[model samples]
Structures are given as structure tokens and as C-alpha cells.
Target: MSIPTGDVPIGATVLALAEGATLTPVWANEIGGFTFRAQRADGTTRYIKYGPHNAEVSMFDEAERLSWANQYLRVPVVVQVGADHTHEWLVTEAIDGASAVDPRWIAEPRTAVTAIGRGLRRLHDALPVSECAWLWDPYSRIAGAEARGLTVPDRLRTPPSDDVLVVCHGDACAPNTLLDDAGNPIAHVDFGALGLGDRWSDIAVASMSTEWNYGPGYEDLLIEAYGVEPDRDRLAYYRDLWNAT
Candidate 1:
């Protein structure tokens, strides 16, 4: 996923959803979904995410997860959720902060990466595993990949033992964490796959994303910020699993 650049077409459905609010495209995902920031004349703000029907991503699932996580974490408040035969959409009340991968933060990798680490740790600590009803475990992920008709390597079928169970962000990449102007993480977004899983599942993905966004050598720093020693075996396994699925 990446921030949209240049002109992005505004669909009629999205236009109706905006209800005359000024809309600006903010995020474009690989699967063709677009997230827009909608600001009204009265100064209220909301985020609208719209996309075609895809089994791999579900706005309804995200809305549910966001509502559940909001009680324990700083996440967007779900305002509306709907789907038809061809498309699905979710509307959420705007929250304060910019994505860690925003251009402003991109220029400051240290701050962005550090905030992502701390933010991820906070998410894992805050969301209770016992209360969560979703699953992002290895078996589920592998099954999801197979359902998508992707081949998984035999080696990936066996995963490392769990270190600790927590409610994972599912997509813990840098872009998902939002940071305040002070370079501290205030909230996280994009919870379509949020569920209970091993903490390393998120740690591996978050640290690995640093390389994709900010470049190398910052992995250990993020791990340190998460207050954990590097578990080479778990990290390697999860990273490989992520690639496979």
C-alpha cells in the first residue's frame, strides 16, 4: 500500500458517502481500495475507505476490529459500515496523527521507526487476548493463502513455538502506525486482519517493514524499543512465513 499521488477518481458511491464534504485521497492499497479524508464545512472530519468486493480484504471485518480495539487502544471510531453486491465501504471518525510512513516522517526514520516500535508494543500490551475473537495464527494464515490459491512452502507449515500471545495488528507495517507531531505514536489504523497471535508475528513484520520504508540497520533499534532481545529463530521464521503467505 502507498499514499495516492496525482489525480484519483472519485466514485459516485464515494461522492454520495461524502455528502458534499471536501474529499482528499490519502491511501491506496494494492488491492484497489482507496481511503479518503473527508472534511466538512463545519470542521468535522471523517475517513472513508471504499473498495470492490474482495475475499482477501473486508471493510466489515475492519470496522468490527476497530470497534473492539477502540475500548483498549487509540484507534479510529467506527461511524458506518455497509456493503452491496459489488463493493464494500467503511466510515470512521477522524483521529489525530499522521501515518509513520508519511513524507514528513519518512525524512526522519529514527523517529518514525522508534514510534512504530513503541506503538506496536503498546498495541500488543493493551488489547486483551482473552477477549479477542479473531485469529491471525499460522494455521489460519496458511489456510488463507491456500484459499487465495497461492502455494505455501512445506517448511512454512511448521512454525516456531509461541513466545507470548497477544492481539496482533495483522498489518503492523510502518504505514499502519500513526504518529503525533511530537514523533510519538498516538494510534494505529488498518485492522482488517487484527486478531490474537504471537507477538513475534507483529514484531517480525514491523521490523522487516523498517527496511522497506526507512532502509536497513534500524531493525535492532525497533526491537530494543519494543523491549525485547532479538529472537533470531522466531524472527526468521515469521519473516519467511510472511513472504510465503
Candidate 2:
């Protein structure tokens, strides 16, 4: 059922690797990976993600994490996962809705930002910390950086006291959250970095990302929607760690 190969980018490579699929490029990430959408004979839509051989992030890892997380939350359901000699790819059923950073939401930062906070709380609470098998704590993250020949800046070496421990999203940028037209969160995407860590690890970067994606001032709105006072110390510390690591 493979579609006739054409001039498509990674679509051709992933299609060749995973039989019975014709895909069209849908999204490309900062890392040299591509996401494609495909229409199968059963009339279902699937998304395929391909990470270049040398890319730092692992698509296979993301797939495995998605599979594990699916037990507790609404993450993509894995359809197939495979790797050729040089590239790794995973295919999953597409989750509905658009990213929170979509243009329409960008114009309405209040709604988008608030939804992100509420959704993040839901994710943090939904996943039980006792059952989580992975860690993204400062110790592990620092060690990971050292192995890559990178040094954590002195300031980021120490994290502020944990406000509370909950399962973090690992990479909690605004775009990672999917929202329906009504500005309600449907599902979250991009689990490449999913792991257990200080909730602030996700909150800090998520707040910081508001500035990067929507400009300043919405960070506090997110905090309010989360139903907690801002932990300034943790926010500052994790934002530094985010850039350092």
C-alpha cells in the first residue's frame, strides 16, 4: 500500500522504512526531524516522526515514553516504531486539535496561556510520581550535560528548594500543548523529553516560553490559572537550567 514515491522530503524515507504508508510533511522541529500525516486504508489519520541519525533527541525514546504515558494520560497511541541504519521513526494516531501557539491563539494570549496552565496541572496530577520510571532531576540532567562535554553554569548547578514534586512534562513549551478552537486543551504532544522532575522544571520553561512565543506579561496569567502563587526562586533557577542544559 505504499504510495508512489515522489519528491517528498523525509516522507519518502519513512515511507520506505515503514511499509503501506504514503505521508506528507506536516511539521518540522528545531532538531532535524520531520512529522508527517498519513491517511490509511481504514480512514484513520496517523502521524509519523523521523529523527535524523545524528540528532540529539531520540524518536524511539519518545515513542516508548508515549506508550508508557498512554496508560495514564491522553498521548498518541503508537502504531509502529522502527529504525533503519541511519534514522529512527515512530508512527502514531494523530491527536486532535491545533497547538496552543497557533496564530489564532497567539492573538488571544490570555485564553491560550491560561489553558496551558490548567492543562499542565492536569498532567502533573494525572501521572503518579511513585509509578514513574524516569528522572529528569538536576542530578541526572547535570550528568547528561557533562557527558556531552558541556558544563552547567555555576548558578544552575544548584536548584532552588522544590516547591512540590509532581510528574513534569520535561519540555513544557506552549506549543507542546494542543488546544481546540474553544481554547480548551485536548492533548499534549512532543513527549521526547518526558520524565519525572521538579514541577518547576516544566513551569519555568513554560513561563519563559510565553515571552519567546507571545512576548512578556502572560507568564503570571499562566501562574494564576495553575492555582498557585509563583515560586519566584524556583522559577529563576529552572529557567537558568533550561538554558544551561
Candidate 3:
């Protein structure tokens, strides 16, 4: 779909509240499906995210999930939510870090890859799965996407008959990972797709994304950092499915 533009109501409100607040756009693109930035005022900065869409199942739900995950995981904490005729917005406290795709990180692929891998492992190991209230099972996700007219890759439309479910960052692209100045991953973002699913569901997509976002030969580094051999079949399958969606 075309990217939405013009002033977003929710974003405008946050910017107004921080009346004299210094604000800089961090991400404003099509894929993220929202606009966000760092708002600084009085030496403190808050990460503000908002979209010019109805605060319905997707954006609002994600806002709730991210807010809740902060109580348990090292993710951003939502500070506010509001909606208007043109949009819905969620503001959150900013974490101290930069996107893993930053030039500093690009200059140190090994460090970036290692940090991402380790962080992924930590998330997979630490998130309290038994209690999370959502389920992003691939089968269900595929069905939902299809119902919404989102094309699904044939391979992913049918659920694999034999994979145990675990909590996964449904969209585990490298950019979603944030790193500290020291190159350590401090937190993750975009929990809209968080759910119970196969470990490979995440690993597969994340591994392939390394190549897409960072370039050649980095997939192995990410896999190594995650402490697993690459599952070529799963990676190929899921990567294709991800591209289709």
C-alpha cells in the first residue's frame, strides 16, 4: 500500500505536549507502518510512535502488548495512547541506543551480528511464555493475513505438522533490534507480531533478514551468534513466506 502522509493527529498531539520539546524523526517509512521519533525536552527524551489510522486491533493492541512486555522484558514502555478522526498514537519512553543498522554498527558487523544473536537468544530464553496472552502461530497468522487480502506464500499457508510453539518476535528483522553505544543489544521493538510459535519461526526469518539488510555472509554470523547451525530449508521457506506477506 502507499505510505500515509500529511500531519498525523496523534503525532501532532505528542509534539504539541512537548511544546518546547526537541523532536527528531527516527523512523518514518512504509514498512514500519507508523511514524516515530525521539522527543527531547529538559534533557530527557521520549520515544513517540503514532499512526494516522483508527486505534483498532493492530496499532492499539501492539501498544498494549509493548506496554505489558516492558513489565517483563527489556522493551520500550508505552506512556500514552489516543485516537482522533485521522489517527491513533502510542508514546513510549525511549531506550538509550541506536538502530543496529546505524553506521557505527555497519562498520562493526561482527559486533552487531553477535549482539543481535545473543539478544535474540536471551529474549527466547527469558520471556515468560506460559503467561503471555497472545498467540502468533504461523498457521493462524497466515490465515488472518489471507482473510485481509494479504497474499500468503503457498508453503507457509499450511502449518507445519510438527513444530513445538514458543514465544517469538513475529517480525524479527535486524532493524527491530536496538544496540547500546557499546554495541550491546539493550532492547527490542515492534512487538505487534509477538506470539507463541516455533523457535525456527523466528530464527529462520531473522537469519535471512541479515542478508537482506546487512549484505552477504552475515547470515552465518547471526546463526553462530544464536548458537545454532542454519536450517537452510526452514530459512528458505520462511524467508519466502515473509517476503510474500
- The TM-score leader among the candidates is 1
TM-score of each: 0.98, 0.90, 0.87
- Model 1: per-residue Cα lDDT over 83-155, one tens digit each: 8888899999998888998899999999999999999999999999999999999999999999999999999
Residue 138 in model 1: shift from native, Å? 0.4
Where model 2 places Cα greater than 4 Å from the true spot, the runs are 1-8, 17-22, 54-56
Error of 2 at 89 (Å): 0.5
Q: List the residue pairs that clash in candidate 1.
A: none
What is the TM-score (0 to 1) of candidate 2? 0.90
Instruction: State the lDDT of candidate 3 residue by residue for 56-139, as single tens digits.
Output: 146677787787677767998777777777766667777889878777888888888888888888788877789788876767
TM-score of 3: 0.87
- Give, for candidate 1, the lowest lDDT window spanning 10 residues: 51-60
Sort the predicted structures by TM-score, highest score first: 1, 2, 3
